[model samples]
Target: MASGFNQKNKQCSLQELAALVPDGSSIALGGSFLHRGPFAFVRELIRQEKRGLELIKQSPGYDVDILCRAGVLRRVRAGIVAMEGNFGLAPWYRRAVERREIELEEHACASLTAGLRAAAFGVPFQPCGGLHGSSLPELNGWKCLDDPYGSGQKTWVVPAIRPDFAVIQASEVDAQGNVRVHGTAHWDRIMSRAAGSVLVVAEKVVDSAVFEAQPESTLVPYFMVQNYAVVAGGAWPGSSWPAYAIDYPAVEAYMDKNSDLRAHMAAAPEAQEGNHG
Candidate 1:
């Protein structure tokens, strides 16, 4: 049997990592819209022709949009799916949901994060005070229960969302598979622990000893990472924080190239291969 340390050191190619995710699996993607998502791994997934994936995210941008455009998603559970700031909505995702081509389970960002937290803690559900008066509970099938300790107050409880796989892109990862995220962790940290399998793709890979110098920088511990890959510009077209900026022109060009869903699906594999390369 492989030792614990050796198991944690399971580094592989992007294609090999993508192959671990079976079709129809529930997948949680790291990053909040335009930042630090495993874009290269996602591209590899598309190339490998996996389909019927259930996507979960706090706020999705290219990662979710591209997958939906390629007709790989069967359902989406997210707080929101849009290009942050001036970019507006993720066109493909909006169209798919609007056309009833894909099922959507929406929640407030905090609720989604809370659910992942619950999963990470191995709990049945997590209660939040938010969404008490909103119709989101009904729309998304979340439950509202009376607070046992409060003065007859109702609390909305979100069920745990333990996905089959969690794919994340980090600023750096050490040889032992400890991942580091420079800026915001978003929901990646919790999501990594919430998933059955975790894959970390890093902009750079360093020696395990590096973490000894600054342990606080280690965001995702090695035990939580099942597979790791070193892919430069792994989060291409999206910002990876302190390391690189979002490739706005590339993103715009991609959006323009795949504006038509039918055409994009027909040529997705070839187009994405070139894009990733």
Candidate 2:
């Protein structure tokens, strides 16, 4: 956790921020399904050829699908990976798993949250009885233990999943690294705490005075943030609440199984200079 102790301006370009992700690193993505997920950053990873990444998210769609198409990800840990309704499944993700090109470890949303919470709490594991009647515990080999209080109840505990980094998309961020999220945080807060460090992708950059005036509104205090980038439309194709909504046409093109994503990749600035072939 970088405490912004020096009060340094943590801003950088999208390429600079994405470069911090190592090949084969385990990274947690903020947002759920199609909303506010960092698709722009994912594109940069593909362009940089940051291969063998393990993506962790509660729900993901376009980001994971495109990563799979680019052969950038080797494994995925998530509850469910799909395009929000009407678009149906994340076609590329399904195809990759079906072809055995990617390893998928599925979990219930609750189980995943419990695992993240445990890591954020600085604990090795957390007990959860929510997995009952679900095969996730057995499939993932989670440990089942008896309560120490003699309650005669068994609790299933999941191992902590600490990612090397957590990438979050925020509505606004100050030069000092303080972030303000206009809507639901989803699991971004927990991921920030559970991760080795946090990288924020913001839609707008405001002055430090805005934060000092209302410190309580900061969703991710500068202390938990390590680095950040300001891209006006950073969450493109995904909704950045209070600013914009999901872009349906872009999503449709992405959902089209025939698309090679070369066109889409060429459109993003960070990927334009790199060879997408």
Using lDDT as the measure, which candidate wins? 2
What are the Cα lDDT values of the candidates? Answer: 0.81, 0.84
Encode model 2's per-residue lDDT on 237-268: one tens digit a residue.
88889788888887888677676588977665
Best by TM-score: 2
Query: After superposing candidate 1, which stretches have Cα over 4 Å from the reference?
Result: 1-9, 257-277
Q: What lDDT score goes with residue 159 in model 2?
A: 91
Query: Which pairs clash in model 1?
Result: none
lDDT of 2 at 22: 87
What is the lDDT, from 0 to 100, of the residue 56 in candidate 1?
92
Off by over 4 Å in 2: 1-6, 269-277
